[model samples]
Target: MPEKTIAEFSVKYVQVMDEKGIADAKLMPRLSDKQIIEMYRLMVLAKAFDDKALKLQRQGKIGTYASHRGQEACQIGGVYALGKNDWLFPAFRENAAFIALGFPMHLLYAYWGGDERGAKIPKEFNALPTSIPVGTQLLHAVGTAWAMKLKKKKSATIVFFGDGATSEGDFHEAMNFAGVFKTPTVFLCQNNQYAISVPRSQQTAAETIAQKAIAYGFEGIQVDGNDVFSVYRAASEALKKASMGNGPTLIECFTYRLSDHTTADDAKRYRTEKEVLEWKKKDPIERLRKHLEGKKIWSSRKEKELIDWANEKVEKAVKEFEAMPAPVPDDMFQYLFAAMPRRLREQRDYLEKYVNELRREKNG
Candidate 1:
């Protein structure tokens, strides 16, 4: 038999803006000056929310929370590309994504505070509650996309996960199904370089995470996750292709997690300060700020106004979250079923009575 060449593949890496904040004008996405400013504002809000969440966690105001300190551009940029009717299936650590998609800040605050009510998304938005189990939401996203395809809808679905998720069997299966079915879905993997303490080098052997999509018969693109414009352009293009009935696109966002994995995690144990400092030079918010300044669209006064506005919004959300009524002792059993199961009802009633007794004793 004669040797023959089967196929050759290539992956594209996108970067509209460099670390020095200079952008390739021809590669810039079509966005108004106002919209670009809004992107910066949203990134600021994400950082503000993250800072507050960490403080709240330290003070025992909220439970152990995941912080998206450095990944704001990856989250917000991709999410901002979605249409109103598009759906989002997110893994945890996506606070900025939710905010960019117009989710209420107070609700996100409540969720981090361990309140189940916060997961109940408003009817107008098409987003699922946060999935804590790694790589599991891919199935849900695929199913939603299949449904959209069956119904012949123009909307697409985006699923967000981390580098670690790409190693899961569920991720591979989801990709296969998405390819075979030709579903309108976008797989957005935020490769933040670290899956908790494990580094990206330890996650997989593949040269680039984006190449994983080729096995499933789809195109994958790697973008500068720290550059908001690059991430936004990749996501926007993928979404448009999907809406036009194209199959899935896997976007590998090459970024870093600036903070510890979560409140319970101490990244210093595994990584060095020098490494963190190196990544800090590519900080997304600062890069965008620099870009805006070069265009003369941003000034010291505008910076102050932006920070103050973000602070005000965060403060209002915190107050609302704190002022909300406490969950009833039996509230845990209420959300799962329209009518409680018999055995669950008995347990709930017992807890309710016990809580009442405790209240009565306190009153006396």
Candidate 2:
């Protein structure tokens, strides 16, 4: 037989807004004015959380923290598109997503302060605690989606991970299973350009992360991650498709990491200042603010009010987190199982006695 091409594919790129704040009216999604304002506010609130966390980490009030500085649009826009019944499976650094999903900011603060209770998601919210391992939650999200499908539920599942995770075997396994099972899931890859000093270029030779979905028998789309409208539209469409039994979709959010990887690392050691400066111009909040300004709904006064409101809210959350009672170290042993194992129980008893003896000695 003659050599022939059996199939061909092209990835779609969605960008409803430009860096200068000009939006393509024809491509704009059907979002209400209030929704637009809420989107901007959520992004601002996420930024406030990131800034506060970084400061707290510096002051030793919190452990190492990751800041979602330049990727607010990608996080907030994707998460805001989710319905109440949908479930969110997030990797670490999804502060904007959590805020948009209505996760209490104080609990989030407490989580970073090394208290696992902060991650104890409420029953009403269908969100899992942030997964610290790279790409592992992809499998978890796929499993959840498979369960939803088996139950004939109308809900969908969205999972978020960084660009570097694409190289992990778990990502491929999850994608393969999700495709084969026809699970209602959306794979959201926030291509923030770098994954802990490893640039996206080094992570994969593929031109775009969205294209990876083609091999898994699903549609994939890339969007301007810094453009809130674009990310929202793409995510909304993908989620709707999934819920309607169209199977999974991969949304590659082409964004940037504006801050260092975390409190323990310095970005200055690897990337250049010029590159960082360029991405800063594509600030998601500023772009949305510009669009609001063009619509005559935003002004300097509104900007001040929003900033003041965000600051006040963040301060209140900080106070609540700090004022919470200290956690009992023994409590960790109680939550692991319904009935503690003999070995673990013995270890717990030893720790309790040691702690008590130290306390008594200090008192003496």
User: TM-score per candidate, in order?
Assistant: 0.96, 0.96
- How well does candidate 1 score on lDDT at residue 159? 96
lDDT of 2 by residue, 130-241 (tens): 8888999999999999999989998899999999999999999999998998999999999999989999989999999999999999998999999988888998998998
Clashes of each: 0, 0
RMSD of 2: 1.5
Which pairs of residues collide in candidate 2? none
Cα lDDT of all candidates, in order?
0.92, 0.92
**In model 2, where do residues sit more than 4 Å from their true spots?**
333-347
Question: In lDDT terms, which candidate is top?
Answer: 1
Residue 320's lDDT within candidate 2 is 96
Error of 1 at 44 (Å): 0.6
